[model samples]
Target: MPELPEVETFKQYFESTSLNKQIKNIKIKDTRILSIEENIFINTLRGKKFNSVTRHGKYLFVECNSFFLVMHFGMTGDLEYYRRGEEEPKYSKVLFEFTNNHILSYISTRMFGKLDITDDYKKYINKNRLGPDALTMSYEEFLMSLKRRTTNVKTALMNQRIICGIGNIYSDEILFRTQINPLTKINILQEYQLKELFTNIKEILKYGIRKKGNLATYSSKLIIPHRIEEENCPICHTPIKRYEILGRHGFFCPTCQKEN
Candidate 1:
């Protein structure tokens, strides 16, 4: 799944390549990936120019002259910008042809992504009950949300209603960096532990954005707990462990993140 960092990358790419281009036409190879009616979706975007792009959690919002286009990259969604006469991506489900003869294609291999149009982006976010964006959330706000949670700390980190943008992948990284066991109860966390967790959340997420969410490019000093089952802990040389937590697979260094 494309998390916050990946979605932010998409947003930046969309802004750089697709903005200011007048929509000349739209081709929908599959209507099932659209949230709105096929004709309505086509009409809503056919003539507008993308003025700006923003993201919240894993959703990308593209502002047009009169409306906003929202995109969710479910699991395998991506965007490709190509010039006229260039071959479109193999999984290109929707193609946006610009008056300048360029094309922006929304590619989704799994068909789980969605595209919709809305008049008010803020209203749409509020309607969906999304929490504050993970990257910009203040430390105070994080503590407040954590104080109200009774679940495992890892689960709390992944809860979109508490703090958006973090999914399973980043949650594992955050917990690993903090040296917190994934199954550790929220109430049992010490003050310093909480502080460390908060700091690591910000740092790790920023690093992710900088690396554009490519785990392979991450430093060996920073462990990638979930990338492989047979990997060893980079710090203590202990074998990395994996187990189910909160119905999702979690990976950690058992020696480093011992359950108390």
Candidate 2:
């Protein structure tokens, strides 16, 4: 799944390559991948210029001159930018052809990505009840958001209504960095611990974005590294531990992130 950092990276790319380009056509290869009717989606975007691209949580908003195109990269979804005469890949599920010969492609191997149209983005976001994005949420706001939730700390972190853009991977990394057990009750957190957790969340997210999410790369690579067994904890020398909770894989260092 593309997390917050990955989504932000895509937003920057979209801004650079596709902004202000007038859409000449909207092509959908699979009807199941669209949230709105194919004709309506095509009609809404055909003539509008892409004003900007914004991201909230795991969703991307391509704002046109008059409306917003909602995109959710369900699991294996990504975007590609190519020029005219460049062959569109077999996986380019949806392509937005621009008047300037640039094409913005949405590719999803699993067919889970979504494309929809909306006149009001704010209303749609609110209706989805997503909390403030993890990248921009203030410390006080983050603390309050978690404190109000009664679920397990890990579950609370994953709850979109409490804080946005944190998925299984980042949640594990955050808890490991803060030295908090995944199963700990949310209300049991100490004030200082919450403060530390806030710092770690911001640090991890920001660092991930800067690295272009490259978990492991040879040179100038941007990918999110998935910590697994036998890997050393970046902060401490403890061996990384892997566990399955609620059927989701989580990683931690027992010596560093002691259960509390």
Q: What TM-score would each prediction reach against the true structure? A: 0.95, 0.91
* Regions more than 4 Å wrong, model 1: none
Clashing pairs in 1: none
lDDT of each: 0.87, 0.81
Give lDDT tens digits, candidate 2, residues 87-189.
Answer: 8976788999999988999888899788888888878789888888898889878877776567788888888889989888778878877889888888888
Q: Give the TM-score of candidate 1.
A: 0.95
Predicted structure with the largest lDDT when compared to the true one: 1
Residue 104 in model 2: lDDT:
91
Candidate 2, residue 236: lDDT: 68
Error of 1 at 129 (Å): 0.8
